[model samples]
Target: MIALLNNLKTYLPFSLLDNKAFKRIEESAQIAYYPENTVLIEENEIPSTFFLIIKGIVESKDGEELIDIYHNDDVFGGIELIKNQPSAYQYKVNEELICYEIPKEVFLELCQKNSEFKNYFFSSIVERMDMLKERKESAKMADMMLTRVDDSILHSACIVDHTMPIIDAITKMENESAVALLVKNESGYGIVTDADLREYILHHEEKNLTIISQIQTYPIISVTEGELLFNVLLLMTGRSIKHLPVLNAEEEVIGLLELIDLLSHFANQSHIIHVQIEKATDLQSVIDASKRIDTMIKTLHLKGVKSRYIARLVSEMHKKMYAKLFELIFPHEWHDRCTLILLGSEGRGEQILKTDQDNGLIFEEGFEPKDQVEITLKFTETLDAIGFPRCKGNVMVINPKWAKSTTKYKEDIRRWITSPGNDDLMDMAIFFDTFAVAGKISIFKDLRDFLMEQIKQHKAFLPHFARSIESFESPLGLFSRFVSSDKGHKDEIDIKKGALFALIHGVRALALEHGIHKTNTTERIKALNDIGYMSKEDAGDLLETLEVINTLRLHSQLEKLEKEKEIDNYICLSTLSKLERDTLKEALKTVEEFKKVVSYHFHLSMVG
Candidate 1:
């Protein structure tokens, strides 16, 4: 039984146990083995003892369908035991099963005596609770931001030749209410519009006699057939054009892209700003583009375009601008040789505003250069110019320490995790979440697999890493009030620090434990739920809480950008809508629940 307890300790928050505690656990545990397809535990039944699998498989079921099947070394049932509640899902053996059954009181005694073990156990429970709250919020938010370009009906316009008279084109524009005409030219297609006509009337002064072809805007802005009208709107707004010709590769006109055609697709400004970021060439251009981003966010805040959509739009723009900045510094030849990987918030497509840089580089194997060091420094400088503030801990690719070939990078990660320091381990946590944004995706995949392999080997890293999740406190303070301070900014709490970071960091830890790498908070929570890291109710709540945080941060960043302040993650709840404020309060409450769960899992002492 003592040997059995030691074996179970490997998966049972062992970090929290000492010699005596281990012995106590050993005495309390009941070792049992069963053949395949036997029901080990049933849903809603009171768990007599928390099951710690020794070998074989334990399948968690919902009705008759198998939801999860745990192999050797997986832990469950502790959640129900800790909560003193009924089992939420049925447990059965899908194969020959070996498990050590430990009673709740003995587990509780271990939790009480072992601080680290207690933290680990309670943290998991609290984290699960927080997930339930966030999931609900995220679902409501996703529904609000849904967009479709298929709402508008496409009307076939009268096709005309370039030789058509100005009066003839005017007649067509009036009859069809079409703002533009696509005419076949010797080269491709020419665009003639009311804007073109007006320009001719203003500039030419003798347009009554000039041929429409002479005044036509050549090389019309166009899109491929079947392109979403939403994308067309983005192009038009980015270029400040009113009309675009939809064309096939054969240079034939398919349809006309119009502002009116896409008016119903999205909130106009968000769509337009996305286009602006894509077209921006330099830092100043991005700054200008962000003004529109600011306005769009404000409109969403006012009109209530669910927070999830707002977060998604902000993340999309951030990625595009970063990519564009990279394009500006390193044109096609250089960019193709390496992949720019984004980790943390930006990688997950959940960034609401400017935050610390969480990025790295994955250069192609055997791309050693004569001036590699200088070139890397130059690349980093360019990103800084375009507003990706340097990572405080120097995680950027420019450091050369982080920039490595696929094989070397994997070797370094193994060294970093096995013999970790604060900085090295932090880097591992960040880099582990990385997803490739640009360049060879195959290289990205290889790097991801290598990192995952390391993580699996050193699963102990997760609980240690998860311990940091609770280091930062949630926004709610004494008496359920928000913690307020004037540090960095006056008369306001750093919402990002006090609220969102804790949730994000905690979720990220759980994600690592489960080997789920999807970045969007909602997506992460859902994935955790599917695998039983979080219950369904908890997943729903977490999604909502994330949406609220994202929505608040989005609006705040937009406001800051408007005032010419550099974008940062700070939100003043006073500036938010009543509904937003209510959601925020609820979200903060949910965050506290999340923190408690993290503390529980880590065996950290908690107040409530």
Candidate 2:
């Protein structure tokens, strides 16, 4: 019994239990063993005991269909025991099984005593699953948190008295091999960097006689010894400064922090890639710089950065690449006359990988260049070479239909609103997510204002737009199990159609109706909530659901790339952890609930 209690401490959530609660569990638990193929709990029978598997595997079956497999250290029958209801599935032993069985009454008593344990088992599955995943990610980030600024600082303080001459300070900085020097005066301390010295030398020829205090930057920016290394990096980036003084709690300067030191310690590949992109002068060099994005993304993911922030960073890099391409291909004069618009995911700032090129061109009326066709074709070819595939629907600027003047786009919007059909609605949806990546943004703004006015005037367009979400059903069954793909992949489901499209389209339709111009789904939900179109709680759930779905899709794509397979949105349930599976189910359920709300608001039933 003591050994069992000791083993229980190694498991999660239970490890959080107090000693008294653990003692209660140990005293009431019984050691049980079963032969292979033994039936532990049958469907339709109420569970009287909670089983914590110590060894072997258990298969959960709904009739003849396999629902899930439980391995060692997994808990079963908790939900059934909590609800005091019949088991939904039969728990059958797949191998010789050993378990610690706790009585239902004792488990209930433990729940009453330990709120954390109770919450883990009884809270909403989504919340519990999210907590578990966060705990796992927190464990992974623990080591990074231990890295302090003091650990990364390479040199001791290089200090100069306030009365010291500028020339002497420079000599001292060079002697110490320090990029910056701390200057102390009657008031306090300040920092003088290499850049500051260069500027001082450039402007003043009498550097030898000049006091260091006059040229040194005052009001020192410094980090404490115990501050996390990552936070220091963020501070430096935010301030656009490369050097900082490391101070003790008593305000005494102990060390100096140089950007090179932090960069070497963190080895931020993204920063290196950004520098390379900025310095690249040729198309091939830019393309080469773009290829390092995958590694950067993977590194960020491992560092436990949130998915939304990762997407934002990736989008920023992509925009930089596109802007560089434009600089190389288009003349400086032409840039002011044309608006380069990105449609769909790129415009929405949610693109994490190079998928498709959904872009167009908008020229000021009567300012269309005669060589537009040749230039756009070349631009599209360059983008394709950079790994962005051409849009299957020919949404690229290379298509003459998409390359139009602002006046023509306004007319197109009017036609789409007046004569709404499947293709027109699809085109309108795509255009609604437009963002100007380069060139004249005011031209795109004019078209956007005109679009909102037309959409508001034609009230019938809302129902037509909202009805499109009905094309795909939530891929969850009545019992909350996944509705597997019908395309012969039994274990896989289309996360894009089943969850992503539903949430995105539903929120987008609402945002358009309410005149909220935010293209990102999460931001759109917030805008909807602010306008009283959605409850705060519902909007939060929708945002979290979108995040989880996107995270799962990204992980699947990364896995595919790791295995040298083609990337797609299909996720295999067997490949995921049990916690992730539960979270996904809950996320899909939220999507379904959101769809119902959207349908009720738009009155989609009256459409067709």
Candidate achieving the largest lDDT: 2
Q: Global CA lDDT of candidate 1, please?
A: 0.67
The 10 consecutive residues of candidate 1 with the worst lDDT sum are 146-155
Over 4 Å off, model 2: 1-39, 42-74, 77-270
How do the residues 1-608 of candidate 2 rate in per-residue lDDT, one tens digit apiece?
69766876746667667888887887789989999999999999998899988888788999988887776677888878878899989999998999889999998888777778877876776666556555555555665556776532335578999999888988988886666789998877988886787778787775543888888889888888889888988899899978788888898888777776568456435665676577677887778778768766765665556678888889889888888888888778779998888899988888887778988989889885978889999899888887887898999999977898887888789888998779889989999999888898898988899999998799998998889888897789855667885676687999998889988998889889989988887788888889887788888888788888888888788778779787778998766655677788889988888889889989998987
Global lDDT of each candidate:
0.67, 0.81
Clashing pairs in 2: none
Tens digit of per-residue lDDT, candidate 1, span 322-409? 6766676554665767777887666777655556676777778887645667766776766565456787777776777677777788
Q: Give the TM-score of candidate 2.
A: 0.69
